[model samples]
Target: MKSSIKRYLIGRPLKSNELGEQKLNKTKALAILSSDALSSVAYGPEQILLVLVTIGAAAFWYSIPIAVGVLVLLLALILSYRQIIYAYPQGGGAYVVSKENLGVNYGLVAGGSLLVDYILTVAVSVSAGTDAITSAFPSLHSHNILIAVLFVLFITTLNLRGVTESASILAYPVYLFVIALFIMIGAGMYKIFTGQVTEALHSPIGTPVAGISLFLLLRAFASGSSALTGVEAISNAIPNFKDPAPKNAAKTLAAMGTLLAILFSGIVLLAYYYGISPNEQETVVSQIAESVFGRNAVYYFIQFTTALILVLAANTGYSAFPLLAVNLAKDKFIPRMFTIRGDRLGYSNGIITLGFASILLIIMFKGHTESLIPLYAVGVFIPFTLSQTGMILKWLREKPAGWRVKLAINATGAAISFIVSLMFFLTKFTQVWPVLVFLPLTILLFHRIKRHYEAVGDQLRIASCEAATPIEGNVMIVPVAGITHVVENSINYAKSLNADQIIAVYVAFDREEEKKFAEKWAKWQPDVRLVTLHSQYRSIIQPLTKFVDIVEHKSKEMNYRVTVVIPQFIPKEGWHNILHNQSSFLIRAFLLYRRDVIVTTVPYHLKK
Candidate 1:
């Protein structure tokens, strides 16, 4: 049954040696790891435009300068994370760097922040993708959340199948989205050169507000910083790359950063000149494409690829979140279940948790991409700031060959990231407040989990146990249903435990039944003492509990460990299980909960 499920869920199980074969190359790695950043160009320009459009048309010009600023911030973070890739090639970039340089508490903060961000990335990206579809066909609007959830489930399934395969599957759409964006940019540039975009720009322009405050522009920059959210993911998952992992990862980072910058800047230019504004009906990218292509097939192509890439952007979280969770699990910050790989050697537990969380967010927000966007960028920036600061501290203390130069770069990166984080916090305070609650709570959870693992380790310390001496005595008790072959088999298995004393217990609700059992037992001559349990309440478990308590107390004085061997009924067919009382399960529940008692169930297969 288990093997059937494994094959069905993840195909064949991969051998440990196949680990290297699954490592992703530069192009595929770029597609899988950078999907989040690359896909963000779809709505990132619009996010900035959202704030600008709110204060009216004159405030709209702030987008180009904010785009420039966002590009600069993106460069800083990219360069910062490249340092992270080389300095900590084993991947655990944020948590490891912070713990190594800053402190454990700081690392916990970064870890918690990154965990939240990865979850939010899945939620926001999937929600935005669904929004793209509903925009295309308004009749599908009611099904957006359902579609978003299904998308997450599909992505989770792909990731569980394997990292390389997920990347290979998603690479085409990512590249197509990139190509479509460039085509739109090219078309926009042609219109710009011909001075023909003036009319397009005028249509979507709103009434100018009285003034554009500096605070508003800074807020625009903060909104635009959403594009930089996934930049650090490569550093956190560098080990998943092929040989010369660091070099390949660093090159992928460089390529992703350059492409993101160009796309972001070009989309901002197109948004401004084409006069696209935030609307409930369509995205700014859709507006830009329509302006550039005039409802042509190319326009639909761009929109289709845009929607696909947005949905698939959750691939980044799939690639990085499980790796992050595994790092945390290794350090005893989360449950060990997160450390167990699926048949494809992926962190299956983490992937499932991420998918569930993303779906919850989608349902909670009702698939409104606008509702999720503000909360999305805040979680991402916290880790970005923490990781960059951690790197600066690393350079300052290490003083490597190019320590001074690296220190200055990381310092600038850290400063910019910290400022952006502050802006996000102050600007998106209401929408992002849940993370304020979630981050501290998550840190508390990490510490609590660590303490729990520590306590378990201490209790199970084999070094502290006395060895060389065999267990001196064993008291085996068999709870019997009646005079049956199954009871005889239970006694035989108990004899194998080499018990110094074996007692067969029978619970009887009637005196006549007890006498008949004793007569049958005497004739059978079972090689064990028989104890009859009288139950006034006519309950099997009640009489069994009393007998167990008395035996457990007596054995304590004799220095004998108790082993309760019960005859467990095994139904031959699935439907046959419903016909059984399942009393052995009831007894196992009572016995295994005690500290010093051991319960073993010997399965008695039934012919029926």
Candidate 2:
């Protein structure tokens, strides 16, 4: 029944041979891998305005400069990650680069920071998308959290269907969003050219909270840095591309970067020329669409696609987080389960884990995009700095052709990204302190997990090398509830072991039940010896395990190997099995952990 539900939700299980067939082409790869970066234009410019607007209309002009700075940073990242895609086509992103070049600890830090950013991508993107929705309707504003959570779950399910399948489904919406924005930008530009809208729609009309200064500009820059959050995803997922993965991925990255630059600059330009101010209720893009095509289908189209692409932006995280988790798992820094692929060949464990974590963040922040923006960029730029730094070291160490130019480019990126990261930390310290605290703690946890895995490996290796302990004979103890077929089956299986001694034991709460059981056993006249144990506390497993312990103590000097055979009744229907006492499960659970004891279950299937 569970399998049926899973099949219906995520489609039928995909075979391993079908994996390569799932690699995405350039267009689909752009939609799947670049959606986050593309979709950031919806909120990235807005985040910049959100900071600049604090100083009122006087500072609104700074949005363009801040955006240009962000664009410059974007170009740096694109160039750096292009190199990354080609240099390390295997695609662990920052984790692989930093770990290989810098060391394991730096790699883990990069990995952890990237993980946190991926989670924030989902939260912030969905929340920003929800803000877009609320802007359009206004009535649904109160339920934004619920709306955002539903969208997160929707995207999660979509991703669980497998990467290529998700790309096919998501491709149209992303393209539609791009088309809608371009049309809106062109239409807005035509309006300005034709002089249909000569003046700014709404002039800034408030006292400046603080005068424009270097600190304010840095804050605005840091806020706008959210635009660059998903830039690394293309590098991280090069293997998800088609034949000639690296070249295809690099082309897609360039294409995505180009689109992002055009859309982001256009939006910020329109917002400034139209004199649009950041609204708590409606977004700046929504206002721009209204200014260009007021309250019409085009306007709603912009809003709808903006909401859609933002929600799908979470797809970047969904796509990258699982792959990153797989890398960490392979290194023994996380549980090995993350390394296992699901029936659909995607990393289901990592996908589902990212889903739940993002949902939690949405709830905690109450789907407020502004509240989440402060915490978003630090995670992104930390890895950005580390990855670029790693690449610099790579170029120097490997000295590939044109290594000097490569080193200079990476050095520029590393310096710029490091400055941006520091600015984000200094400007948003109050809100971002938790993330700063999270980085060290998460890295420490990774080290501890690695240590645990190493310790386990050492113990396993030692055990394999040591001599086996000598055994005198086998003693089989079968716990019986009554002289039923299940118990009879268990005893027969125990006798088949050809042990030195076999004991059928019963634990009874009262003398009456014990007498009845004894009479039944006596009439059967089983070959094995029968022992009865009395439980004053009405506990069955305790008395049975106690007897096994006593037998083990008695045979300790001789080293007799004790085996507990548990007889479990198997109901034809799975749900019916829950109605039974489950004593056999308890006995096995208790004895299976013992060093000297062997536990096994013999099942008797019932027809009805």
Candidate 3:
């Protein structure tokens, strides 16, 4: 049954040779990687408008400037990360670059920040996707959290199927979304050219009251920067591409960047011309769609596809998070379990961890996109700054062909990103404090893990082992209940160990049972002697623990080590466990924690 579920959901386990089969081509890679950036155009503009409209209609015009600023930053990141793809073709984004150039501490910061960003990406994308749905149906408002959770589960299962499979499943929605945006832009542009436009069907509340303050303007810029969240994914995932991985990844990155810039600029421009405003229900894009195509099918098509692409955009995090965790694991900065590939060649533990984190976020925030958005970009900009900073340092140190030009571009990008990160940190400090706390703790965890691995390597060094205590004879102890086949089998096992001595002990709280067992043992005349301990109170583990303690103490005085071989019953049928005493488990648990004592489990299968 378990195998069937595994096979059905993730397919058969693949061999290392079959890994090449999982490599994604350019189109599918673009779909899987670019959806986050593309889908942001849905709420990205809305977020900008949301911040601007707080001041009033007069400030609403500032959305274009904030968006263009985000666009400039976006272009800079694209240029900066293209360099990263080629340099770190092995595919370590900010973390690898920073470690190589800036040092281990900087790498930890990049890695921790990237990880937090990936989790937030899933949370923010799922919430926004659900918001899109609730905006369309409105009736599903109460169940939006459930909807968000189910959608994340759906994407997680798809990804667990394998990267190529996930890309194939998710590719079309992103393409459709891109095509839809282009068409929407063309239609909106034609209407503008033909003078076939009107004011927004509804504008924001009242006219401009308080003139825009510098802080408010900068706040709006920070809010608009959410659009740039997923741009770094391609740089991190270059290894997932086919042969000529770096080149293919760079091409895909370029394609995604060009598409995002066009779509975002066009959408924001149309929103401005149509005079769209932030709304409590529906989105700015949804509102713009209504004004562009009225309440017709085209408008509905836009909304539906917006929701489809938005929900699926969480796939970006699903793809990137597992890989990021795997990278950290390879560095010994996280558990090795995250590095293990599943049947589908996905990082199974990492995928499950990301999914659970996303589900918790949705539950905690009640699927409110606005609340999650505030915590979004701080994670993104940290890596952007680090990656670009590392790239500048890379070009300076390597001084490759055309190095000066590369250096200047990366230096500009690094500066811009540093400023953006600082702005987000300052402006969103109250709401983003948890993220600030999480990053430092994660970095500390990385350091701790590194130290642990280093310490383990010290203890497990082969040279150290050879110079250590030499093993001699081992004393083996077996615990038995009565003179039965299970006890007979355990005694035979102990004799096979060739120990200096073998002892079988039984604890009896009742006097008659002890006498009966001793009589049976005498009659059988088993070569191994049985020592019976009478417990004044009804206790098995305490008496057994004392016996092992005595054995251990004697072994310490000499060179011999002790082994407690416990006989465990394996019930053939699941329900049979209730019929058997679990004394073996109790005895083993007590003995297992003692130092230098070897504990082994011997399973005696019960046929009935």
Candidate 4:
């Protein structure tokens, strides 16, 4: 029944051979992988204006220069990541580049930073989408949190349905957003060219709260840099492309970068010409739409598509984060569960985890895009800086053809990215300090997880057992909860092992219960010996495990092996499981770590 429900929700289980067929073509890949970068136009300019607006109208002039700076950085990243795609086509992105060229610590830092940034991408993107919705219908303002969470859940469900399907579902909305913005930009341009509207270069309005300083400009630049957050995703997800993955991925990266540059420049340019400023009540894009189309159908179309692409922007995170987790898991830096594909051939664990984390961020910040923006850029730039630096070292060490040219591009990217990372840390220190603290702690966590997996591998190494010969005798101990068919089957199974001795161990909390069980055993006349243990504290697992340890020691001294067969009943209904005691489960859990102990469960399925 559960399987049927799951199949209905995520579609039928995909076969392993169907994986190749699931790879995305360029159009679908661009829509799925570039949505985050493309949708940043909705809020990126506003983030800059939000900072500059504090100094009144005169400060708005800085938005253009800062946006240009961000564009320059964006170009450098596109060129650099194209190199990354061709060089590391296997696509671990920054983690792989940094590890191979810059060493493991740098690699882990890049991986940890990218992981945090991906979560922030979903949260900030969805929150911005919610802002777009509220801008269109102010009555929905109070429900932004609910709206944002629902968007996350919806996108997560689509992604869990697998990549190609989600891409097909999401591609049209992204194109709609692009078309709507271009129309709005063209309409605004037409007005300007036709002398219908003049440049908004009015004098300062009201008092300037803060003077324009280098710090203010840096703050604005850092804020605008959020637009570049998802550029690396194309490189990170190169393997998701169809055959000729790297070449196809590079072309897609160029296409996405081109679209992003045009849209971002158009929006920022039009906002400047229209004298748009950031406001709490409406987004800069919304204001631009209204300026061009005045709350008409076109304006609402802009808002609707903006909300969609913004929400679906999180699809980029869903695509890349799980793939990153698979890489990290393969290195044993995280749980191996992330490396396992779901029935739909997607990394279901990573997708669901990204969903929940994004929702938590939405709730914590109350679905305000502005509040989440400060935490977004720093996480992204750290990885950007590291990845570019890694590429530089790779070019230097390998010195392939055109190495100097490639080196120059990546060096420019590294320098610009590093500067941006530092500026964000310094300017947004108060809001971004937690991220500063999180990066090192996350690296430390990676180290700890790596150490644990290494230790487990060493302990379970099969090569270490080559010299150890098998013993002649064995002792089978069965922990019985009651005189039921479960115990009967467990004992019968244990007897099949041909052990020299069999003990049916029972733990009784009361003297009367022990006596009653002993008489019942005597009446059954089982050939196996019954060992009744009295637990004064009513602790069944501890007593049973301790007895097993003693038996294991005795068997070791006699050159025999010890196996504990636990009898566990299988309830026909999952909900009925709560009605039964789980002593067999407890005993197995307690004995699992004992080096010489072999614990097995014999299940007796109940029909009703």
Candidate 5:
């Protein structure tokens, strides 16, 4: 039943020739890779504050330090991953790097981590976008889950059409968000500098609590690290870039890095300057919009634009998940389903699977952006650690001319990323570990799947025991049912076997019908004789088994081996099996118990 449903959802397995229909270009690839990175500006600041607020109002200032740290980490990661893209242009990304440098276990860890991160990217981006929309329309506040699910469905449909299409559609909205954010930041800065600043607009109504602790700082850092989530996508997607893949990928990485740092830093600064509370209660972007543009046309317009960009940002997952699955498929870590392209030439199955998982997450968390935050940094940090580790290994192996400099850079990057990853894990374990539990389980599942495929491959290998060879004095028995295509095909198959003697057997369930069939057969081919076996119980298997036993006994006496050619009808529909029952299967099963008998099926394709 599940197999039937899968067939209905994805259709039959496709041949290799069908894969070429969908191909992605550099611009589209860049758009996809950069969307999630750029879109973080809308919520990364908010997430930081959401965490810091737990430590009291003064902890809100920690956003500045955390943002700076995140910026440094982001730049370091970008530089390190640039080396990765140059070294490996394949689409394996972190998994490929870790597998090559670290080990298979490390690679599995990286792959599993990246898989979870990509899933969270979709969920967080959509939920954040939903929050933006709900802020615009308070009525939607309670129905965020429904909105998120519908948005996931909508994104899934667009992705099903193909990556190039979804990327192209998303490019404009993401670019618009970038432009709008820059304008808002510029205007806010102007207001601050001109001494024309109005009362701190959108300021929290009550005085915020004031205190700080090491745990709060760690939480804030983890929250800020959300901006770093999509940075590795460019490295993983080097192959999707245009010709001169390495250079194009490097440039895309640089652009993503610069854009994310500027946008995220700008939002954090503006929010801080305006006395916007890093309280979990308010989104930084919402406060900024209300402050800068007032609760009027411009404020609402910015809200609408931000919401659109945030939602469209999920296009990153729509693009990355399919490509990641394809890489896994190539490595045999995932089923061949991931390698298949849909009618539109996209990885439709992968995209739909990603969408479903995202929707489930959004629903499970009730589209609450804050609750999903704990699970957010864990997955991203895993890939960051491994990717940086991969770079360090690459530097070690190649030992470039500036060996000392490159090694130092890679070593430092790896150490920092590793530390931050550990911090994120420790800080988020209580709130995030539940979602992260899927990581190791996924790795084990992939390993098992790989083992299963290997076992099947071993079974399919040709064995010397079954090698085709000439049979000595082979006797053939053809199961006949009157003068029909089934009988004709079975006889032809027996002749092809090069048997010493061929006997046609007709089983008599109804004596009169059997007699009529024998008479007709005799009239058509007088040279060939018909042997009839009577079944008083009207059971085909019992009569066939008795007849085959007699034939084998006779063949043994003649010093020959017997082969049976059974004529079988191909069922046009699944229901056709119920109409005809399992007579052929029973006969084949019975014949298999005999040592010297070889049972072969001669299929007769029946017209619908």
Candidate 6:
């Protein structure tokens, strides 16, 4: 029963042909791929300021340089991954890339990293969205965790329903948010350039603080680099795209990159221009909205957009987690259950598991985007580094007839990404070391599962030692608590057993009731003999044990076998157990202690 439950939770195993039914068109597919990248704008700026806070308000200006650097990194990474999509467009993602070029351990590391990042993406986005809403309505601030958990539950249920359903629901809000953000940024930029900017409602400048260090700048870079988290989603989801997978995926990647760059730059620059302080502020989006649209409009707009983006960002994981699981299952890294398709042809078990994990994170972090930000970027960067490195290795091994310049570009891209990843890890480990823990744990889990499968195969390969033979006799035992359906079934089973002697013993705590029952049974069945046993404490086990001993003694004297019959009822009915007694198990156990006596159960099915 326990094994059955585990199998149900893990889902059934499936094959490649089963996945053909899940094919998605380019537009819907692009939405799934771009969700994480596009949603980063929701919290990316806030993360930048969170790091800069230590350096005081003046450090806010550093956001511009960091944003610019992120833009450059984003373009480089996107172009590199575009090559990835073209080369292996079947959605092998970092796992496939690293395995093909960098070896299996590297592939496992990359896969684990991406899996962790996908979970964090959902957690952080949902938490950030909840925080934004609670910020708008401070009354809900204290209950943010509960609210976030509820939101996670809702999103999880939606995703479990199917990927296409989730994608369709998410598309409108995400697109609306993108359009709104662009309009706001464009308007704010116009206001800044035209010298029409009003002073930020709450200027982050003029705040005094201590000295700044290179470490502070590096930390800021690490935080700002979070903007690059979702770029790999495109590569992971390439297989879900319409025909011409590589071209569509590349177009989606490029589109996502350009929009993210423009949005991140605009929000950061506008915040700086309006003198919005990053150190003592809400999200950069909030500050920009407040600066451009005044307190009333921007406050609510930021709230709404943040909520929209966070919810939509979860769509990335909704699509990616199952696909990754399918890949892992195919490679035998994970259990075959992960490879299964659901009724909707989606990786239902994987989606549900990812959703549940994300919800736990949201609950633990209380939907605070700031709290989740540290753990967010590290896993993403690990995969980014490995993936780019894989691309370089692929380029070296395949030596495809790509232009020499392109090969050099891929190598340079890989080198730079690797350096950035190392830097980010060093700077952010204090904050993200938890995710580092997850990486090794996941790898260990994979290997352990692999070993388990191999062990099972080994066990099943062992040959049977003995041949089968027919039994000479079969003895059945039935225990009855009262003269009801239970006893009736027991009598039927005893007759069916065809044993040498069938003993029907009534364990009587009350002498008067025992006498009445014996008289009644004698009148009903003259052939069946009733043995009445006395119990001072109304205990079933002691009386049944004594009765079984008597039967064994008689069997030895008469040279005949003893069979005890126990009547069992279906446990599914609610009141069956309450109305009936559990004498069957006790009687069975008592009879087992005796060498010659055998016990059997007679089942009585009750309507639920």
Per-model clash counts, in order, read 0, 0, 0, 0, 1, 10
Candidate 3 lowest-lDDT run of ten:
200-209
Task: Give the Å shift of residue 449 in candidate 2.
Answer: 2.5
Candidate topping lDDT: 4
Better of 2 and 5 by lDDT: 2
Ranking by lDDT: 4, 2, 1, 3, 5, 6
Error of 1 at 17 (Å): 1.1
Q: Summing lDDT over every window of 10 consecutive residues in candidate 1, give the lowest-scoring window.
A: 200-209
Quantify all predictions' global Cα lDDT against the true fold. 0.85, 0.89, 0.85, 0.89, 0.77, 0.74
Q: List the residue pairs that clash in candidate 6.
A: 204-277, 477-564, 477-565, 477-566, 477-600, 478-564, 478-565, 478-566, 479-565, 479-566
Off by over 4 Å in 3: 199-209, 524-526, 534-539, 573-586
Model 3's alpha-carbon lDDT is: 0.85
Clashes of 1: 0
For residue 239, give model 6's deviation from the true position in Å.
3.4
What local lDDT score does residue 177 receive in model 5, on the 0 to 100 scale? Answer: 79
Q: Write the per-residue lDDT of candidate 6 for residues 529-568, one digit (tens) a residue.
A: 6777778997878877776777667656655566777777
Q: Report the C-alpha lDDT of model 3 over 1-608, residue by residue, as the tens digit.
A: 66788788778778878999999999999999888988888887777888778776666767777888888888888988998898889886888999899998998899998887888889888888888888878999889999999998988888888899889988988888887778789999899889787655324434454767777777778778888889999988987999999999999999998998998898888887787778878788788778778888888788888888999989888888888888899989999899898877878898889999999988998888887786788788888888788888888788899999888888888887887777767777887788768888888889899899988988899867556666677998888887777777877888887888888888999999999998888778467778899999889888988998998888877878999988787998777889878888878777889987898988889886
lDDT of 2 by residue, 324-422 (tens): 998899999999999899988999999999999999999998888887877887888888999999999998888989999888888988988998888
RMSD to true structure for each model, in Å: 2.6, 2.3, 2.6, 2.4, 6.3, 6.7
Candidate 5 Cα errors over 4 Å, as ranges: 1-27, 198-210, 278-282, 463-608
Better candidate by TM-score, 1 or 4: 4
Q: lDDT tens string, model 1, 151-196?
A: 9989988888999888889999999999999998988989898988
- Model 1: lDDT of residue 374: 73
Worst 10 residues of 4 by lDDT: 200-209
